[model samples]
Target: MDRYGDSTQKPRVHKAEVMDEISSWDYVIVGTGPAAAEAAVAIRELDNRGKLLMLGAERQLPYQRPPLSKGLWTGKDTVEELPLRSAAEWDGLSVQIHLGDAVIELDAGARTLTSASGRIYRYERLLLATGGRARQPELAIATLRDRVFTLRNFQDYERLQAAARPGLTVLVVGGGFLGAELAAALSRQEGLKVHHAFAGNAPLAHVLPPTLQKVVLARYGKAGVQLHPQHRLEGLDWEDGSVRAHFTTQAPIACDLLVYALGMESNLELAQQAGLTLDKGGVLVNTELRSSDSRIWAAGDLATYPDPVWQEPCRLEHWDNAEATGRAAGRAMAGRSEPFRHQSLFFSDLFELGFEAVGRCDSQRVLRVAAPPGGGKAVVYYGDGDWVEGVLLWNVWGKADAAREGIAAHRPLMDLHWVETLET
Candidate 1:
């Protein structure tokens, strides 16, 4: 045997090695939410040759989740009207979407993933846009899990709409945006009795100012929606398909339908299992949206990345934030480096009222100014110093861009000079 005879002509030739084929892609993004969809589209725009795979646990194609609670209750078609992109657009994109299939395991070290069907997928880059799951009542009993509802997806709204017949007693638990929105929509159904167990003094105590909270409470009152303020759910009874909801501040109420809109819990199980760095219950990433593992990145609600504007680590779940973060991640994976610096855009429409704004909405102190009798708008400023932290354009249209700039501008909180300038 010749140990070193490579120079000899026709001495020895090694046969071509056959590599076992495993499912592989240039990019594998988990979760079919806004972040994942936007990321895939951006990636396709930049790199046409890379194989992209988007995994979603839900059966439905990727659709906007906001309208599910916002207006789906008003007889909107789930499949026909709710897609983020049209069918033709989806077909045009070179993305392999795995609907109803979820990636259950992620081996970051191996740069591979395993879906629920035992398929191994190797990826050059991974994005975990696996958005959060809706939170439910802690006292939910076993038999009642199916009966109780939470509005996190389009299907949930469809189910709730079917059960929202007249003469039904619906008990909504929570004091958050979803809870308020759902209760308001249900209250419009004549003959249906809607009771909202708000665990705070106001419907949106967590975000809205006390003044604005009053306005919301008044709206709920006018709509015939009963508000059980400062209340908490103790337990639930699922007997004969009816919910006997017991609350701490009120007596037991028997209801035909029970829906709770408690906040959401970030879907961090996969990231945690892979030993990714987590902080404040979210996967921590730098401004580039790169996670601790380097191979894996995160975006959307599940990602807590440094906010370049605020100079702090923040997690935003709004549609704009998701899209922005997703595009940023996609660009980076395509070899483009740029920090994602933008304010979060959030908006909510309840019944007939709608408002949109940017920047932080949490500020205890605000300068509330009412529009002149016919001005058709009002404004709230949360800035006390040079940093204009927030601005609320109540009933104001065509001012979102300017308002955002104002909030970003280092305007004095409120001075006679600034006030005169504002008036002018």
Candidate 2:
């Protein structure tokens, strides 16, 4: 046996011996959400020689969550229509897909990961786009069968769609974006009674100021959406599978279904176990989206990184932020130095009205805004008496372009005469 090889003489090795080992990709993305999918493609495009593997928890191909709130629920788009890429497309790109199994643990020191199915993957660099999960409130009726539902994924959306039919009484628990959209969707269905409960005076009250909140509430009211402001849900009493929702404020309201849209918590268990630092609930990443563990990077809702445009720490759960952050994280993983700073672009539709915004809404600012000509308008929100903190619009498409550009350039909205001209 040749236990010892010559120090000076080179040892001959068969080509088969070197080629027998499977080559792990340079990058291993822990999720297949909007950010993960985008990151994978960007990585491939940036360096063609580098291998790419996208790990997803869901069985289905990567898809967008926005459509779950709008198109899918409304029956305007099918599940297939919202996928990140079709089977053929992913196959053509040579990007490996691992669906239906989540990464159970992360070993940063060893640069390896263990999946739920017991598969092990080693990577030179890892990206966490794990996203977040919906937070469900503790309500008694929520335990009952067919009485409560939380719209988080495709399965949840399908259940919600089936439950949101005519003559159904739905009590939406939260006045935030998801709650507002759900209420609007349920109200549009014939004979469906939708009552939305908010802990504040108006919908998104805490996030938006009194004036904008009032307008949002008013719009919801006009759309046959019942608003219960300043009230909290006590519990629910079930009778014959029906629910009587008890509130802290006035009276008990009988409803068939309850939906909670309070907020979301990032899936950072893997990051935490791997000794990665986190900000709030997400993995804390640097300007280049690198985590405390230099071998790892994070993006999407699971990442709490610095926002260059906002000039502060900001975490965005919007679709645009997901896409941008994913691209930035991918590039960063590839050793690029570009900053991952982003504009907080957001959009939503409640029945006939469409709303979009860029930057954080300056709830306290009073910017003179013009009415949308002949029907639609985009309202720019200001903060610090100068900066354009946010923009909100109704029935306005492409208006986000200006707000996005202005925020990216760090320009103050006050300099624009359009704002002063509308004041008088």
Q: Supply the TM-score for candidate 2.
A: 0.87
Tens digits of per-residue lDDT, candidate 2, 1-424, equal 1111112232222111222233466889998898998888888777877877887776666777877777665677676676778766876766777766788988888788887756778899999999988886666444555777787777678778777878788888887788877777777677888899888888766556555566677788887888888878777678666777777877877788888777888898999988998887788988998899988999989988887775466777888888889998988887776976567578787766677777766555645354555534546465666666666654556667676666677667655654443222
lDDT of each: 0.75, 0.74
Q: Point out where model 1 deviates above 4 Å.
A: 1-21, 76-78, 139-143, 238-242, 384-386, 415-424
Best by TM-score: 1
**Ten-residue stretch with the least lDDT total in model 1:** 10-19
Q: Could you tell me every candidate's TM-score relative to the true structure?
A: 0.88, 0.87
**Please, what are the lDDT tens digits per residue for candidate 1 over residues 98-138?**
66557888888888887665667899999999988888676
Candidate 1: pairs in clash: none
